[model samples]
Target: MYIRKKKNTSGSISIQIIKKIKGKSKVIESIGCSKDPDKIERLLKKAHKRIKELEPTLFDSVKQEEQKLKFLPISNEQVIPIGDELFFGAIFDRIFNKKTIFQSVYKANDKHELFKALVISRILYPGSKLYLSDYLFYFKKKEISDEAIYRLVDSLYKDEVKQRIEEAVYKDTLAKVGGKIAVCFYDVTTLFFESESEDDLRRIGFSKEGKLARPQIQLGLFTTLQGYPLSYEVYHGKKYEGHTLLEALLNFQKKFKLKNKPIVVADRGMLNDANIAFLENNGYKYILGAKIKMLPSGIKDKIINLTFIDDNVTHEINIHKTITYKQDKQKHSLDISQRLILTYSSQRAKKDKYLREKALDKLKAKIEYSTNLTKNDLKLSHYAKYLDIVDDCKVEFRLNHNKVLQDSKLDGLKGYLTNDTTLSHKDIIEHYQNLWHIEKAFRISKTDLQIRPIHHRLEHRIKAHILISFVAYAIYKEFEIKTREIKKEYQISYKILRDLIKHVFAIKFDDGEIFPIKLSEVQQKFYDALHS
Candidate 1:
């Protein structure tokens, strides 16, 4: 039988052809037809009672082969080229292409050695210099030798690199933030060397980290509170921290013309009569830490007589006030001072104990093991004298047993010697606290950026390396600022942005086909946002 209705143009019809035994109906076979009904009826007639023929049909399979063979036109919007703004090891593809920034750096310095130093920071990277040749350029396609790299790295000094970086930062920052309250900060650290050559620049000096008996180089750093570097200088191996202060301040004044005297802030290491005198005579204001030991006996008596008052209501703070005096033996005069404030905290004392124990442990271990002694051993009585603490111990376990247990606590009372007596004690303490950020910046430089042990024997190269570090630091600070400045609605953090960028993948096609190799959703959005 044939039946026809409103021939479904918008839909499809399916017919089944099956075979069955006599009176015993079973779906032995069924053929489904979604295409032509005429063909389905013809197929059903061919089916017999004993045998079965099942045929299946549909509109069509997907046009996959056609898709595989035919090329799709790629629009300009479809192509995403990798831009060059890479930083912190190309981990970040920043707004400014790193190639452009690098070229800018190169232009500012305009020296092959300085360029090589920056590149070394990228390639040499701690371990085996395996990919050194890949980065080399060929004037006539000749491969440069590893000897060339050694010469470049060896010849590079800290001063040349530092000068270029300083100039670059000044130019770039001034162009951007121009004549801001760029609070320049000063601090010093010591780097000890393994070599024993008493060269003019490298001498056995007092290490700020108290690396006594180890020949060291004293480095005084002047940087803005924002981590923008202003100037840096290396002093005699044994120059006192106090001694570098006047020079550093003088250097800052000479290098960067301060139309208005900059308020220089320093820690206890910079407190001295000469430094104070210079600050006053030069029309400079300073916030310096006071040395409790430097105060006279009369001051000590006055400080003990000082009184304390509670200030927990208004500012949730405690107040203590005392009067102190300093006696200059050389001048034969007493400098009567006022306002010695003492605040007590158990937590602070505990922290002091912890750090002192840590430093004492390290120092004691070094002093106990005196092998291959250097000539500078005589000048290290501060820590070297501690060696007698382990005198009874034998060769075995000397580093552990005799030295490790010696306990010492840092000085509890710290005094601030500031010419500006008008500042409330709390304000003075808060300002001094800002010094930690600078110290932290130095720590990050030494640990994260690996700024230690002058690899270049040349004094200038040493200076240049430090200068380059200053630039890196400034850039790092800018990165941090930009990340923080991003609107909360964007919800893009530096770490998250970094993660998104890592998701972006580079695809290379042998047949010149353009496609996404791999990209996360957020990364794609970020890429799109940049383009937008």
Candidate 2:
């Protein structure tokens, strides 16, 4: 038999032998050249010389004793085995996990790492501690401690991380959306705590979501055309939402060193006449929600008679526009009427209906339980008492009760007051609606970044914690943007990108060497898109 061999890209060779040939010379020639080129050529020559001593006649004599080349029952399954190269293209990708990203940030390569780690951690495992040891051992198969990770996360809030994120967002959003605009949307939401008692900064206040008098940190968030965070103020939990706008804007102005007079858009919470007049007198144009109940009868009558467009509506209103009204003449003379755009969405009504029904069901269940039990057994008597006996009625249970769906009609109705009237009404509504992005940002910060009650009680640490979360939100936002751009076929959300990063492959070799591969094309593409 004769054998032919050749090498391929895998650093391995394919060998084919013609074993049917006659004579010991053919056998010897096959044996001599069949030696691998990697080893000494002399060894193959010696082996071939020794094999030549055995004659083909000798093989025929031994053929009966040779057991006829069993061939191991050749099967295709065993013949062409699967190799790692079929799916995995690189080793670095198999090694990538949350730990790698954390370590990369922990090394403090950029101010953005703190944010990147928090964001990646949040989207991967929400409301969970991202320990460095677990990250290293499971992710990189190395040892890293909790203290080191904590310090790295803490450092994100120190000097440049927070400032840089704020700077980057403001610079980019402004550059992307440059035009005449006005009255940025301003509102505050509190991130409540489980405990009612903490520090003054964590005191219980009026909960917007009606969270049970729990300690919360008031987050005053401001956004404009694109709904990107322009500025934010973390207030004491006990502060009022209505009272925060002017101060927040003032702080924003001071921080940004802004002197341009810009209009402000605010909710009804900031509706005091004094506040409105103060904004106008300071050369700042203002559009604010006017509570119908608070307005004089004349203005209320005018509002009722005023025709509203079936579609979204925008009208230029100033103190000048209201001159014909007796109420406006009596209310203020220095104010300029800014544009007032009113938008009503049926979707909001549906949402409101859902909320009211849910809240009412809960309230009804509590009231029914309280009435069925003795007053002494009821720990929730105060809540129950308010629900029962409306207008001195004795408690009665019936299958079809006249349960009032309280505030059902206005359940989903949302009102936006904006001062920038130049933009179309739809544009204004769209801009204001983008406020939900802040809610998403907060979810990631609280649940993903795990920035809550907090670990360190020191004020600096608390500030740092918030700063890290802020940076993380920035990173998360950046990822969302990049992923969308790269995976244009569908939305590549933060969760999907996060999962791809965690996926790993193990590589094994005959020499006892093993290593992980890096990210795949999809993964590297997404990561690169984020930077781009």
Candidate 3:
């Protein structure tokens, strides 16, 4: 039998095999006219088997003339793990483009290497500088020292290197977003130290994590609307959240040389009269958080009775009223002329009412059945505010229901203040809602990056340590943005991305060649999306 090709009228050729019989060829079999090699080989095997069945003598000659294929033995005894950190490093460098940026800033490549290793390690396995040597072995087995890491942190703390790095990162982000930034989100979070002692910079203060007994340092993070960090600051743990934004705002403004004044957006805890005045005096506009009950009695009454049309509403909240301040007013020693955007959320109200009622029930139960209270119970001034003790034969406690009702007035209400009246109330609310961007940055830093429970003792080391976390966060955000841009349908979050990067280990053999472990479909998507 011999293979043959027949060109049809459609100009597509069909492949076939024919038997040479009676001086005329007869078609023995026809394979589809496709260019697939595997399919052709499979069809060829079928044709040969048919021929062999007809002529067993042909198989003897075919076997004698067949070429032998060689197979190599693979040794599994020399397997080694090489994590996908190389891919992470490659992506980090691709986004940062630190080739010349670092050379110019650090005066040499060693510090640059140390910085790269530290930041990548921070993203991979965030820890103290002492662990730098251990993490470096994952990268290239570079012999980094505790001293090298300390010097790196010291360089960041003493000099203004962190700002330079941030500028580079922020510039890259602006390029990603087409170079227009009119609004920024700001928020403050506390990072606690393990030690009980407090330094000037690390003081005991109100921690968001409720670690007031632990000395914490406050961090004010500034990010764009998409949660990419533009700049960040470290303050004494006890510093006021309201005061932390000014330094970062002014520094970021001057550093970027912004063309338009950015409308600052922050949560309610970061709002105060002095901060509003400072922001206004600097010719900056703001969308600061306001407590509904903290407003003047007149304003509060108007808000409580105001009727809202369903013109502009979101999922959980409704914009009820927009009041622009034409004349300055003074209340609680705060003189401000700003627009107040009132919003009410049914969901928030429900949550607030539920939480308040639950808290009230808990407090009432404790007062009734918690036995005779000790000084610790008295020290909890909030719980003690509603309690009345009877010292007659035995101690009895009662809760003041009026105080509970007084707090119910502002259950589901939130207020935002802005100096820019040109923006509609809807726009103001929209901007303030994105403050979750900064909130998320703080969460990533605290939870994933492990910026808290700081192990450093000296102030410079602490500052340097935080600076490393900042750099790591910038890289993490940029990488995250790229992954989203390329493949949003997969929903590769930070944790999933980290796990993907962590699991793709290169398996090195006893020979010089190295092979990467087999990746699943999800892992392949991550690799392609980033590389793409």
Candidate 4:
């Protein structure tokens, strides 16, 4: 048998192992095909290896026996496989190249390659910069030192580079969404650091992850209704979540120069007088969560009395209120009309009741077991209102049945405040439901991407780390969209797809020859989906 290199019409070389039988050439095994000269040479070598395995001569058999005997003393643990590259990394690298918004900011060179590698690693294997060199060497077969990575990160934190990236991603996303954004979603999350020290940017605050002792920075993200990220901002950890909305929104609008104002949607945390006035005074429509219990007694009573025939029906109440806000050291008031859309769900009601009962049970246990209950304990517990403390020379605690009854009356009811009168109440509710998309984005970033517990001490490096995670999330969303489009019956999750890609790797020889392992049926389907 001999190795054969055949030229295909597509201007590529196909290597195969051929044998001669009865004066006719028969293809024994088709090794592979490639367009590059180096890959073609590697394929030729693989074909030769295939020929030796198929028809072994006396010398080849002796050589195989010698190789087996040479490694006889080595145990399985010592026989480590080296020089294997992650095929999934290559797939994601291709995806990153196609969706990257940094080409205009950074040139195509080692720095750009390192940036791409960092973003891809954030998705596949998130860790510290110290491991970056080893990660790149294993995945891309390239050498990038830790100091080079730190330098690139510092450069990435520049205001010019950050603005350019945001603009590019915004334009790209706008094009993807058909050049118009009628509605958008905004949300904020906290990313804590691993150290106990505090700086200008990193300070201790109310952490959503319950890491109150660790210093954290707040991240505000703006995304399309479908959860495609448009822009992100890193704020000081101690800033109020509500205060971040206006800055992020104003900056995004000013930078993008949007002609039409998109309706902003956020949860109750962003419902503040200043935000409402800013959205209204600037001619921007908004959908914000309303604190039903905190409303005026007259309005609250009216809402609690309204009866719902079924879950399908919704009740709408018109509210007119004057909001006072401060700007330029001047106080101003604006009177605005909004529709408070209230919906009832049995599932939601059950969840609310379960949570309240759980909290009450814990409060009761604490009161019964502990003899000395300090006022600080009551101050820290949110369920303190459900208990009445009597200080008559001795403190006594009792359950407030009236407060629990009042809360039960409002169970399962959710309110959404909107200024858009054109859309129907059902449309408003449906639009508000899309807020879950942003929540899911945060979940993926915190868990799958591992974006928190930042180790960088410098402010610029922390910002750079967040920027990498932002870009990584964009690519992840694209992958999710593609996988959904490819498989209509059932969608493949990111975790499953990642595992499959992990198994599809290539072996690299000392002479720069690569032999890709055969792909499973499902793996091939997924691979084709990405390549296609």
Candidate No. with top TM-score: 4
For candidate 1, report its TM-score. Answer: 0.57
Query: Which runs in model 1 stand beyond 4 Å of their true positions?
Result: 1-84, 88-164, 171-178, 209-213, 309-342, 349-413, 484-532
Local accuracy of candidate 3 as per-residue lDDT tens digits, 155-264: 76645566667777778778766788778888888888889997799798877898869998888888889888777878898877888777888778888888877778
Q: Which scores higher on lDDT, 3 or 4?
A: 4
**Could you report the Cα RMSD, in angstroms, for every candidate shown?**
14.2, 14.8, 8.6, 10.8
Q: Write the per-residue lDDT of candidate 4 for residues 1-532, one digit (tens) a residue.
A: 8888899999999998889999999998899898999999888888777777789899988988975665455433332222122333453454344334355544546666777778777776667775566557655657866787788898887777677666666776787689999999999999999999999999999999999899999999988988988888899999999999999998988888989989999999999999999999999999998888778878888888999877988999999999999999999999999999999989989999999999999988888888988667777877788877687333467888988898788898999999999989888988889999999999989988889789999998999999989888887776666556655544766666666654555544444545464677776665566556
Provide the lowest-lDDT 10-residue window in model 3: 66-75
Clashes of 3: 0
lDDT of 2 at 383: 29
Count clashing residue pairs per candidate.
21, 23, 0, 0
What lDDT does model 4 reach? 0.80
Off by over 4 Å in 2: 1-133, 136-184, 194-196, 259-263, 274-278, 286-294, 308-339, 343-427, 447-450, 453-456, 485-494, 504-532
What tens-digit string does per-residue lDDT give for candidate 1 at 168-240? 5555554445666434568888876656666777788766666677677777887666565566777878788
> Each candidate: what lDDT?
0.52, 0.52, 0.71, 0.80
- Residue 107, candidate 1: C-alpha displacement in angstroms: 10
Poorest stretch of ten by lDDT in candidate 2? 81-90
Q: What's the true lDDT of residue 250 in model 1?
A: 79
Model 4: lowest-lDDT 10 consecutive positions: 76-85
